[model samples]
Target: MPIRMVDDPQDPQESNNDGGGGGGNSNFPGGGGGGGLFNLLPLLLGLFRGKGIIFLLIIGAGAYFLFGRGGGGCNMGNLSDLGGLARGGFLDPKQFERANIYEPLADDNTKNPIPEKANLMAYAPAVGNQGEQGSCVAWSSAYAARTILEASRSGQQGEATKFSPAFLYNQIGLDGCQGSYILRAMEYMTKQGSVPYDKFPYTDRDCSRQPDQSLIRDAGAFKMRGFNRLSLGDRNDAIDLRAIKENLAQGAPVVIGMMVGPSFMQGMMGQEVWQPQAGDDQMSGFGGHAMCVVGYDDSKFGGAFLIMNSWGPEWGRNGFGWVRYNHFKYFVREAYGLEPMPKTGAAATAAFTCEVGLVQVTQQGNKMVAGSYAPLRSISNNVFETVSPLAIGSRFKMEVKNSTECYIYVFGKETDGTSYTLFPYPNANDATKTKYSPFCGITGTRVFPHDKSMTPDSIGTRDVMAVVVSREPIDWYETNRKISSNPASDYASRVNAAFAGKQVSNVRFQSTGKGTMQFTTAPSQNQVVAAIVEITKR
Candidate 1:
């Protein structure tokens, strides 16, 4: 998961497969080419989850507020659809544990001359509506941004079918019409991926129905390679306009989170450019929404970022409108760009099966998983369900072989709620070297306990595990000491914080394997991959 300079899956340099995306393709009804213009919205995190009989009542009432109240052409959105919009754009660092912040280097401006005006609208899918649901996060990132990237990158002619916003929104939110965070949606797209609209479709209420095995596998094709922040805060919490334009100039559409007042929400349809009039500030009632930036023009209304809305094509100019730079600085809170995953199918790990269990062995030679390990595979999906469990007090060693060799930090919450690091136990003799597990190399499978086999303390003992494989070198003394001190504390966050601002790939699954797991360094110095599993009691 190396960070690419441009909008590329790998090798930032231009390739033959970049495709001709100017075809103005679309799959959503009335959605097609942007006609040289586009628009945006914020997130939905705290909206009420209309449920049971109450949900039907709310939907009925909401329809009136959204449609009936606005008696004319193009309703920007109503209080029913615009409430609680600004809830997902990175309010706290601890809030999104796995989210990364990517700042563009000034060298970009020096090396790449940006166009005064740029438009990715031609590459964008037709406008999509989030309805009354607080799922703008999914619509913008999963359905819109991801759709734009896939359709543009695939070299496919004609319009491209949309990836399901519901596939992401339903899975991430708590329930009903409650919205989700862009961070979660982006992470899901990068790792698990989203199913096509034909598979899951869109829903304004209820979050039931998920991907099946077949759909899950197919989702791999639409997975995003990764995502990076376009602009965060410079001065006065406003994002850098230059960086936003730089990315768009490269044909990369940016997904943004912004605040919207009544002026924009209640009366934005006819405005040439979206700049709030009097009393347009984001007061408590003003909603925060998510949208896509498909184009920008320096000359239009004195510089603007053309936004693509999820309010359907009836709003603005075909659901797209320009926002002045100053207006954007005042309201725009977050902006991000996505990279496409190579169409070479899913990750290599997804193509194979693994078994991670501990065997009561009395020897030590294979420092790695002995048999199934392949030379080419670097990372794997999940090992297995339950490593054949061991009897109480049995001496055992983990028998395993991973295609990729890397250091493993075994930390997990025991069934009783105790937190502990399983792999690198405190080495009293030498704090530098782990007491139980150390040395992540593939010359030969090493000993499970380094010198002796591990024995369980009790018969009914069980602990769920989070196996973290990092490419960054660790200060063993500090990591082990810090994690060991808080066995029952939130040490997992500490382990996670170590990889902040770095690319992280999370693939959690259950584990059933060799007796004792070991540790090693990853093959490359990029991306921290972590997997979670439950330990079955034997």
Candidate 2:
């Protein structure tokens, strides 16, 4: 065997010994000696540990990528494809088409006195510290514009004032913050010109504020604002944009003015003369008051001017007067500015016609029903059927052309002459009242022979009756008293006398098959009245 030399444990000079033994030496590995197993163990362990951790991390990342991303991804492709199914390849085609549409410029001939576009800086005064005064002036200008527009639409030829108290009050509240009031009023009118009549219920008190329960305490409870109170087919501002637009589009005249006196009352009295007209004193019939204009003529005032007024139709030249143009403009700018007209439309008129003819009247107890009988078959023929129904709770004007022979009972309904008892000559004692009563005598103009034997070769041979319907028990005493009370007035008062004491829930006519069965009498009375009739609906 080759000779194997083992180094000594400690030898300074021995080549194998090297003298760098375990004692705390820097060259020592585990024990301060080089090449020791303790030092090498750490390096070996670190290499293997790092490799294991990195492998585990890689596996976790792969798992997350396959499971997490695949499970939660959105289906954007499905949403993107839905546009193909829309009507116009868009979500809302109707709105889209209207959005990009263009409106033609309004005709110059149709323009009103007030300019379509309002220039506040040109007409209005600069706003000063007294903001309220400025606001009031601005509101007055807008009111003037509104009145001018109205007059133009009505075909009223004249120079109208742009400023109006009614228009201002409507635009601004009596309280402070008149600027805000003007804005709201302008917004309202620009949107809708006519405020619903029913909305502002009439109160017994002075016309200061809106009617409320306090005002109606003594008056019977009734709706102040609603469809029932307005004229037929009238809509509120919420849905009447077209009406407002039409009014503004007409290019009506407007004038703004300033009162020189200390108060509105004094200003009207001419205490301090500003723009004195020749007969202005005569125009000041009422106490000192400020008025707004509705129309004007530039030639009359050497240029253009506006009309003004204080009273309604019953007062002051049908509720209108006039003012100068530049003066009115200055007043308007001092206040604020005119508001744009609303984009709404006008109120609808009633389609039905009121005609006179023979209407069958039948009354039973407290109820009454009526229908017109005509030989013709057109809508104008006054014929009604099951489909073409009469309005419920409608007032009627009934007359007694002749009452010499037949005593009218005004029965609510005919019941085989057995179900209910008939009061004889119920409407006979009041012969004078018969002139206004629904139970009129058979006049030759409307009367026809009841029986062929009575009048041979009679052209008009149908006997007409006026019908009244009710649900309560009929009071003969009250009926007769009412019929005879006001004989000179009209037939409506006489008929209303019977139902005046009782509350009426609803009233409708029995439908006739032919169009000739409509109401035959004209609606000329002011009181509540109805024709009486009975018929079996087919």
Candidate 3:
């Protein structure tokens, strides 16, 4: 594992994720590289140029995030003060990291006499200590930065608002050892949201900790609207700083990964401010370490970025320090920022959600009967259910009846992890097939797989179907092609995004085609309900 973390000085064995190194937990499609992958313009014009070949190419390899590739990073000698610095391999699980590099705004401010700067420290949570573990990615993202965003949005502060890095790190890191990727952490937060610190504290490093229903609910309460990566492509330092400052100016914290070596380890300790020193580049690197830029100072250290460290108050000034621009330009590996979703007026967006069910088919004497309901246990908050749609000829459908004008979507995930839109079936005419419908403009139930009963493609194939509704008009073909990178996670993340934090409840199901797939699908705290049915080979 290429892990870069500040080693816990007291515990020499467990290196702090403060230094990038090996270790992680969650599975990755290595997709989420950047928005570049989903360039709407060209993609809209020439979608699936080779049919499914392009998507498969994207899913198979990544120009970035394909870790375990490079080896032998900066060398950090045996350091007793901080835990062992990982030798650098896969530091952040998000190594499949893709930065959304922002272009310089039209009113470029880099030319201003006073350098561009912003301090988001007010919105940030208290500095945390990761102790002797390689969880800096978690501490930086979930524990600190995400907590800041959530607390600011909800106006609920103190310990209750803080998200648990342990909840993220243990699950995202390798086994329970140490190390993780920032991208994986973001995916978890976006798809499942983050639980409060109290629910799963950092002291417990059990990466295998399974969350119960309540924890799952709490985790789903809030999610990032989305994230943007910082790109400094062909830009001068001043312009690059402006883009970063712009995000911080919005009061959103920036998560950063930087190189830490012998000089970094030695110089960072008890230092008022840190700048790259002579021979610092020559020394072996302990590993890449992750941190959060709460603010920046144009006047400090030749225009420095104010950093939040998880090494605790003992390091830096009360768990904070300034890293100069030169250091950032040379050492920093990646940076990503996330925005918060609205707390209200959510209903105005997309309040509609779909209910799904398995249709039991049997021959009743002389007549063939289709559409008998199967049992699905209704969970309180989230839509969680399992059905065994065994054998061939198994039927399924999704019902959406709504007062709101919403668009419905159905997706099918194959055994190989690739997925495609199932409902609003694509037609031959490109112009007419502009969008799929069963548009929820009028009152009445609309069933997906409506044209014909949805039957299992093959018994050996376990097909999973999800019914979803979005108020925003999503180009289904475009979105489907975009999410094909890692359908297992990305597809669900897209649906969760459509749900828009609605609390889902009372999802109903009628086994027969008469009652069909259904749900009240109301947003409980803005959650739109949707569930997946696994077609089994019984």
- The lDDT for every candidate, in the order shown, is 0.52, 0.26, 0.54
Better of 2 and 3 by TM-score: 3
How well is each residue in 1-538 modelled by candidate 1, as lDDT tens digits? Answer: 0000111122121111111222112122233322111111111212434354466456545543333312221112332354322222322222322333333322222223556788877766778777777778888887778877777766552146578888888778644555555677778888888777878877675667666788888888666767655443222233556656656765567887776656666466655577555434312244457788888877766567799888777668887888776667656656666743342333322322223444433323332112221111112343322344445444544333343423545554543444445555544575455422232322112223333344445435443445555433355456545544545554345445545555343433332232333333222334455444433444
In candidate 3, stretches whose alpha carbon ends up further than 4 angstroms from where it belongs are 1-104, 110-115, 156-160, 233-240, 346-473, 476-538
Candidate 1 regions exceeding 4 Å error are 1-98, 107-110, 232-236, 282-284, 343-538
Per-model TM against the reference? 0.48, 0.23, 0.49
Of the candidates numbered 1 and 2, which has the greater lDDT value?
A: 1
Task: Give a tens-digit lDDT track for model 2, residues 1-538.
Answer: 0101121122122112111111111121122222223334456556657578577556545433322212121111111111111000011112112111111111112221223222111122111111112233222333344434433334443233222233334334333322222233344444433322234422212224533454334222211110000000111101111111222223422222222212222232332112433222211121111233333343433332333333223222333333333333312211111222222232111111222233333333432334454222332111221222223222222222221111233422111111111222222455322211122111111221110001111112221223342221244445645554544443334455556644222322223353333332222222222453222221
Report the C-alpha lDDT of model 3 over 289-391, residue by residue, as the tens digit. Answer: 7788888776665567888888777677877898766556555666766653543565554344444455454434532234555555433333334444355
TM-score of 1: 0.48
> What is the TM-score (0 to 1) of candidate 3?
0.49
**Best candidate (score: TM-score):** 3
Arranged by TM-score with the best first, the candidates are 3, 1, 2
Candidate 2 residue spans exceeding 4 A from truth: 1-180, 191-194, 198-250, 253-292, 311-319, 329-538
Better of 1 and 3 by TM-score: 3
